[model samples]
Target: MARGPAATPNPTVAARDGMVLPAAGPGTGTPLAVRGLTVSYGENPAVFSVDADFPPAAMSAIVGPNGAGKSTFLKASLGVIPRLAGEVDVFGKPVEQARARIAYVPQRASVDWDFPTTVIDVVKMGLYREVGLLGRLSGARSTRAMRCLDRVGMADFAHRQIGQLSGGQQQRVFLARALAQDADLYLLDEPFAGVDAATERAIIDVLRDLKAEGRAIVAVHHDLSTVPAYFDHVFLINVRRIAEGPVATTFTPETLQATYGGRLAATHLDELAITGGA
Candidate 1:
């Protein structure tokens, strides 16, 4: 039998990420395409016309300095924004129709940390899509929720209050929540923001596993240093597209500077580092 990284065969990915995805069926392997994408806040344009596609079965990192519109782009792709000028297509189909096949992990900082909730209770939200908006949860769904928590090393904290968890632990919970959805496309915004190295590695390992499953991952990441080492595909964007390609090509300093709006000093990068995002 022929084999790709996951030994499926017919897998044709070229991210140079050393990140390989499982063999994906041709029918579900369509990439996420954005053309003439423009997002704005009132009269102030946030993102200019942009064009690109996240190929299926690849890990793509979106990086830039502060105010680069990386998170805005993710919102546009998901139709969460009020008005958008560009077109977003997933697997050559409209994004709205592909909702069930996609999952989203917004920044940990954006969540109401003080809100009263338990770890497992948070993850149970992920199953809502599959169980249905009105679907009652059987024990099966609850079991799956705990299993997902274990996957991210949060099994012990399943009953702990979400506000009490550390930054890294919280981030892992976000990953687990998304995994519980079992979607084909994953869009994460600053998942590693405020996360410790160990937590970062755990999150990365989960993304890698998802890649191995042939799902597409798009992360809004601000850590420029890890872009090359962590992602196979990179999209450097400011208000417009600066550079996009395999990390080997798009992770260069020139592109970094352009994407961040001129040369960024070390101090500036530190400031741009996301602690919490909404």
Candidate 2:
């Protein structure tokens, strides 16, 4: 949804049924928030009434079955796609006004890996917002880009064409690009998909470092087993948000069953014990 100026907090309303809507108040530690966020494709609604907060220094995962509107939420929130109804805020401000502080890494499948671009070139693209379209990445910007690549273990492949790299290598390169953006709030779409174990570990480490820096990271994750281990918070969804909170409390067996509609077998729930899904 295209947003206007930041809206004032609805003073007449506070918490509804003891639930804190994504409105800002004194000491609301949330950095990214969505209220009544809805999106549709033709006559079909993809997302419905998603209201939540991306708290500071937290790694939150949006988990659900395929076609659950996981990708649609991210795109709609970022204004990359039109929404049926919603409001997105960053640090108590509207998303459009806070675009500079937000960085988005779309799913690898959404990108054209065959595009003719070098690793460094792709990484440098992150700095284009800071540097003008015609601006060059000289001095500090160049240093930052290279440092980001190094962090993702892709510094050695800076000169290689992106299409020539392996799936994991390409994911790492794209992650490096997001790191180079140096934004406070990151909205990633399946950062772990199609990546090797080592790359997944590296990406998780990077997410931890970002959390340490007081940044908020939200990713659309598919692996139920790793959801508890990887994310501090989880949002269980199926077209609409089912439950969202700290992993320990919110990721229960009943909740998972509700989210997945009992599609998860008993053995599968038992194995996801860490997620409290047993």
Candidate 3:
């Protein structure tokens, strides 16, 4: 596997808004790094040679068209799907070695909501690493799970069946499950899709809180209008990476045009200019 330059020293402790973040690990300054990542479906390539660096203590948005392989990039980097070629580093270590420090929230649409499980049980799934898959859910662990649910305003529905909840509520529950993991880096796929505005606001607020606590957040975001307001870093991709850097500089009209190709209408570009000052 390929590797980047030697890790540099970072602060042992980070304090923000009266909350002390977890001490940094040996090489956690960069939460995630992908080099020459490529994935394919037989003869067709999904994402090709994508390189990205996700900064710690920041929220980064991955944006592209529907078939641009945004989700493929995330899945391939995490080893969830087979990659033709690439290297993924998490907290300056191989992804396998850093699994405990990362949390993933897959797209809600991809989940089987009809599964016969209660909300609390679903949240407890996040604790499998610490408690073991077949271990009993003790009172303390249950309490912790409830706390995570409460953070997403779903504590009252903890006893309800997952499929019984609304779309927004289900999304919140998934996020709560991810929170229960208490990981240093969070990777979410289309977290705000198919949800109400209030749910979107709540989700973003929690993500911002996590960011303020010095956690790294990376999400496959589709709403271009919200990119400028919700993300500090932006990576634009269409099969391959078009541009990546701070949103203020990299998320310009030119990059958007390049990423979307002819799919983007002139009016949408105009709207992005007015809304994002791109």
Q: Which candidate is the best by TM-score?
A: 3
lDDT of 2: 0.86
Give each prediction's root-mean-square deviation over alpha carbons. 7.0, 6.7, 6.6
Clash count, candidate 3? 0
Residue 134 CA displacement from its true place in model 3, Å: 3.7
Which lDDT tens digits does candidate 3 get at residues 1-278? 54433542444443767675555466445899999999998788999998999998999999999989999999998999999999999988889888889999999999889999999999999998888867888899899999999999999999999999999999999999999999999999999999999999999999999999999999999999999999999999999999999998888888999999999998999998877774
Give the residue spans of candidate 2 off by over 4 A.
1-29, 274-278
Q: Which 10-residue window in model 1 sums to the lowest lDDT? A: 269-278
- Whole-model lDDT values for every prediction: 0.83, 0.86, 0.92
Tell me the RMSD of model 2 versus the true structure: 6.7
| Candidate 3 segments whose C-alpha is farther than 4 A from its true place | 1-27
At residue 84, candidate 3 shows an lDDT of 96
The residue-by-residue lDDT of candidate 1 on 1-278, one tens digit each, is: 55656764455565578765544454454568888889999787788898887877889988877887899988988998844688888876788888878899998888788889999999999998788878898899999999999989999999999999999999998899999999989999999889898999888998999999989999998876677567889888888888888887557656665676556875654533431110
Write one digit per residue (lDDT tens) for candidate 2, span 122-238.
Answer: 999889779987776788888899999999999999999889999889888888989888898999999999899999999999999999988999999999989878888988889
> How big is the positional error of residue 42 in model 2, measured in Å on the Cα after superposition?
1.9
